[model samples]
Target: MSADLLLSKLEGVRRTGPGRWVARCSAHPDKNPSLNVREVEDGRVLVKCFAECDVESILSAVGLGWDAIMPPRAIDHHVKRERRPFNAHDVLVALETELTIASLAMLDIGKGKMPSDAERERLLLASRRIRSAIELAVDND
Candidate 1:
């Protein structure tokens, strides 16, 4: 609920500060403005009676309910989540290791001989790791 709507229902409302005001307590008879009303940055209305009146009682008197002034259930404003599971340093280290393996295999092939069975397995693992790193880097962005 907006502060203006709440203030309209109140009597003898006077500005106390930015986004804040004082009004006569609707729950009880008041000769002075004892009720405090405020609108916070998150768009929630706040009400308090200095005569020690409960919030529920003050809201009830003004035809307002708990639901009208409740805070938002979920606020996603400026929330930054961890988009990548692995940090850049870790990913770089992994890619470097895979590159070393691939380089060794390439060197063997450049020597006019194919990599042995075990070297072939290592090359396959390196290929898979490089492909996986590429996917993670692209998808997270």
Candidate 2:
């Protein structure tokens, strides 16, 4: 699989600040963030579960099969490996990421404004910009 494709799929799950990701573990009842998926060397994915889950199990949880993503020689090795399918839940995650970024931008705009009507108008405009970015992503999909 292309790294770009995988990166796109991981858009929302990738956190922006200190922690690099926010993923729900498929191996456990993850009501909150329990997994961190990161891009390592040679486009390999590095995953760690906060709940003390194993790597293979975490791979299986994301709905990804090794054959399609791993090298041919490694296919048999990862035959039993699996990941959660990219579904509505994944989409929601991406959308949430986009929204979070947008929200930050909105906050920045708000902070920049003084005690004036123009500041409010600029904040609204900045928020619209964020909304537009999200709409574009959905439309393209």
**Residue 37 alpha-carbon offset, candidate 2, angstroms:** 0.6
* Cα TM-score of candidate 1: 0.50
lDDT of 1 by residue, 49-121 (tens): 8889998988889897766666444133335444646698988898889899888888879998899999999
Measured against the true structure, the TM-scores of the candidates, in listed sequence, are: 0.50, 0.37
Against the unseen true structure, what C-alpha lDDT does each candidate score?
A: 0.83, 0.58
lDDT of 1 at 24: 96
For model 2, residues 28-116, the per-residue Cα lDDT tens digits are: 78777677766544435556779999866655556555532455545454554444343666657756765675576667768984434
Clashes of 1: 0
